[model samples]
Target chain A: MAKPLILVSNDDGITAPGIRTLVEVAKKIGEVVVVAPDGPQSGMGHAITIGNTLRLDRSIAFDDLDIVAYECSGTPADCVKLAKHHVLKDRKPDLVVSGINHGSNSSISVLYSGTMSAAIEAAIEGLPSIGFSLCDYGHEADFSHTREFVEQIIRQALQHRIPENTSLNVNIPKKSSEPIKGIKICRQAHAKWQEEFDERLDPRNRKYYWMTGNFVNFDKGEDTDEWALVNNYVSIVPCQYDMTAHHAIAMLNEGWEF
Target chain B: MAKPLILVSNDDGITAPGIRTLVEVAKKIGEVVVVAPDGPQSGMGHAITIGNTLRLDRSIAFDDLDIVAYECSGTPADCVKLAKHHVLKDRKPDLVVSGINHGSNSSISVLYSGTMSAAIEAAIEGLPSIGFSLCDYGHEADFSHTREFVEQIIRQALQHRIPENTSLNVNIPKKSSEPIKGIKICRQAHAKWQEEFDERLDPRNRKYYWMTGNFVNFDKGEDTDEWALVNNYVSIVPCQYDMTAHHAIAMLNEGWEF
Candidate 1:
């Protein structure tokens, strides 16, 4: 008869509107304990600060929820690491959720996303996890339309359960004329970011460059995350981090002559 | 028949002795082209620079090899992105190999390795790829013993070709008085990093934490990356980026009515 114990995190720092929104939605479903990065970690991917130390300072940002929230001075993966071993050592969370990110983490964006990295870290710990992201990349991107969908998915995940070794990558389309067209189960679109760097010079005239890129979705398939997002539906792509190409194993065996 | 156009890259930067040795070995097997990060990118994982500009500068390090080499001001994955879309646009690499990384990229290290990410990026591009790492992490890590192993694998790979969607995660244990105990096609060991931070006070008296961790390999399976490394053997685990837990899918389907 107890509510699910949910471990919440995000790539957009602890005080970011996105994670605050995530914490609010999660608290309604269960006990929410948040451990997230102290700063924006948008394109951090699966990085862990191994060569540096980590700091987890308690935050009063979400006092309304009466939740235990910590701002970690590390990557999203490091947040999960600290939460599991240090913060929540005695109790195991029923589900771990990350993001409600400020930008899109659909398709190949997932590969470069720290939002999903937090979820992937939990999956590595054998916990059922999900990462959520919005297509809009704004500080105060409206998340009102996503609240219902986010709550429904979390509730269902607790009532049922996701598969092992698999974590859900849920991406919501930006503010739309129509409310979300409902959730669509889809695979990650086969896509990549086409890189284009903008060279800049500081006030002192030292050359520096700002990294920029455009997302190119070559996959026109309807069953992909890109297609789902374009159709005004939140896409739930069950992602795994094992990276074992099972299809190529047999062929490699044939080619590898000892 | 024309030789395979091999794109070589790594995480220890383009100048690390590890990569120089890798390029030396790769030149024998194919038309090697080096595209790696300009500086050390240890533990970078699958990161791609998005909020900043990426620059690609030709390298003089491999001038002797007559190979086209570029040093990208980005992560390992970013290097591959530039190589594919910008540098090698006309010809797709027949094989993409990354790292003779100066450390163990076995088991859980795979998730945090910039080396493996390049290989995974190549696999995503539908090219046969592999990542090679030495068990040694020292700057002057001895690579004499790795030549035979590296050459043999690439030759076999180029001749027969690797399986689709898979890339090799090869690790060579440090050279010893004994010959290698041969290769073990193994799975990633179940492991986790027990992290502890070393906090320090800055000049302004603000506390900052430095990241540190000890790897713990809990999986005692005989056929695992950790076991192979420990037993003085090379570990070759074929890894793919698809993270779907196919077996768990059936279970989730039966349990979760959604």
Candidate 2:
């Protein structure tokens, strides 16, 4: 049997340690192709390059590993589009994986995640996809402990296939002394970033603001991604691109006069 | 009773005619505040400014109407964040509204919409929010006919508060000789953009690509937003930030091995 073709991308750029780790693991499983941002695109969400042109260049980042890779001057979502419609052309990838991101994309953070945006973009294009993230924010975050779990999840995803029109948001706990309990298929927790803007002045005395925020989890449900991550289990939340609140339809129909 | 304070924003920048129409409608209902992007940030989705400092400058655009307005050097989501955290300060807005966008943001376009991003950002911040879009994409789209519907929707939203944690994604059909039938409380149609990148060369002979696509609606459902729009009805889809595919959770739990 031919090896499953896996397309790899990330928000932390093609050269980031996270994508390198993902490439290493992906190559061992199948044919791997990397199409990622040329620079860090954290919190890019589902942004695409519309008002500007995109430049896709061949990257030497994965040359040593004998893997094909391209760096794009666009958002994570744009990289996926370029990969699908430009680079790969007619060659369809069996699975699309994004990240091994150096930070958490659990709960409300998913709305602001470029890592998951890549995965979700692939899903929108009717491909099975998964986005992996580590709960560590360090520049040199330890991905060693996540390798085995990432491999396992990818293998299972390729085998079972992801749920229709959905991408898996898998967040692994950072390297800790304790072993991971197991994997938990969880719902997105109800949470938000309690934002605070730090006001500052530049040399010209012009005021600017830096957005800073703390994650606040309001959901105490054990079946939530936040709960799974807090309990040291790999959290997998099946994320769908359809933003419609189906339950609210009836409410609006009943209450709204128009 | 005191007038309801309405916070207004858009992705088409501070000076766009789409926002001017929104302001014209919103101010009639309540005290209005505008915080929007300094330039076009279309297709920005739910992006936030994390890697850079944000600049918020007072706008003279709304000066004639004596409306308080500021333009931010960031995405639509960033403007909402600045409005909630810094600009508005202790005063909580009774409602938040974004866009009478220059183009359509129905079906899958919602995933790439900065117009909806501002409204969704406000929703995450626990505010009743609605994003309005005109199906016309012309530089000078006819928003004259949309005034009554916009005003009606805003009034209804204020009188009967929007569903919790959900923002309304309302798309008004382009003005035609035939009057709009009515409004439809609809679900987002299953659709996607069939993207084709137009390869081009820069002046320096470097390769660049322009992302272009045609919207394709796969859903034939009468209850969908696409159907409503096609049939000349204003479509209102209640959008939620939670991307979780809850039904797929049970499937993953049963099918996948740990």
Candidate 3:
């Protein structure tokens, strides 16, 4: 049987250590094809390159490794679209894996994460996908410990197909003395980034604001992604593109007169 | 009793007709404050400006009007954040309304919509919010017909109060001979953009691609946003920022090995 074709992508550029690690793990599972942004796109969310042209350049950075790679001059979501519609046109990928990101995309951060956006784009295109992120944000953050769990999850996904129109957001806790706890299937925590802009004056004497924020978890539920990460467990939250709050529909119908 | 305070914002920049219309409607309901992108930010879904400086310039465009407005050099989500954290600091808005957008954000388009992003941002901040869009995509699209319906929905939202953490994604059909047949509360239609990149050569002799797509609806259900719009009924989908596929969690837990 032919090897399963896997498309790998990330928010932290094509040359980042995170994507390189993800590619290595993906190569072991299938014929890996890497299509990612040319630069870091950490907080890009689901942005696509509209009113702008896109450039898809074949990069040789992954030449030493046994994988086909391309660097795209667009967001993480754009790379996935370009790969599916242009690069891998004739063949459909069996699964799409994104990240092994430099920072955590757990809880509400998923809404602003480029890593998960790439994975969600693939899922929107009817392909099974997963996005992985580490709790560490440093550029040289160690990712060796996440290899086993990443491989296992991908293997399990392939063996037992992921649900339709859904993508998994897997966030691993940073390495600690206590051996990393097992993976936990969880829901997204009700959390948010409390904004605190650092107001500054530029050289031109113009007032500019640099956004800084604190991640505040409001939910105390044990089955949440935040709880899993805090307990040193890998959290896997199954995310869907359907933004409809189905439960609220009934309430609105009852309360709203118009 | 004091008038309700309403925050108005959009993706199509501050000067666009869509936002101007939205502002007009909002003014009738409350003491209005507008903070929106300085330039068109279409397709910027849930994106926030990070690793960069943001500029919020007080605009005099709406000086003759009763509302105070500012044009910020950021995305739709950024506008709402700036309004909530910086501009409107000490006071909490009674409601947040985004758009009268120049295009439809029904179905899957919601994922790529900056208009909806502003509303979703407000929802994330625990505010009752609604994003309004017209099915027309032209810059000079006629939004006059939607004015009555838009005002009605906003009044209803304020009176009834939307469910917690839930925002309404309301899309009105373009002007027709027949009046709109009331509002339909529906779920998001399962639809997607079938991409077709128009490949072309740049002046620098480099190959560039223009991303374009066709909207394809896979859902046949009548209780969907697409169906309501097609029938000339205003569609109001209760949108939430929680992307968790709660139903799929049990399946993954049963099938996958940790």
What's the residue-level lDDT of A176 in candidate 3?
Answer: 76
lDDT per residue as tens, model 1, B1-258? 887799999988999988888889888877989999999898888987766666677889899878889898889988887788778978999889998999999988898999999998888778888899999888778999999999988887787877766788999999889889887777788887776656688788766677677988888888778898899988888886656454554565466544
Which regions of candidate 3 fall more than 4 Å away from where they truly are?
A: none
Docking class of 3: high
The deviation in Å at residue A9 for candidate 3 is 0.8
Better of 1 and 2 by lDDT: 2
TM per candidate comes to 0.90, 0.99, 0.99
lDDT of each: 0.84, 0.95, 0.93
Residue A83 alpha-carbon offset, candidate 3, angstroms? 0.9
Model 1 regions lying over 4 Å from their true place = A1-3, A138-140, A194-223, B1-3, B64-68, B198-207
Ranking by TM-score: 2, 3, 1
DockQ, per-model, please? 0.49, 0.92, 0.87
Looking at model 2, give its docking quality level: high
Ranking by lDDT: 2, 3, 1
Question: In order, what fnat does every candidate score?
Answer: 0.52, 0.96, 0.85
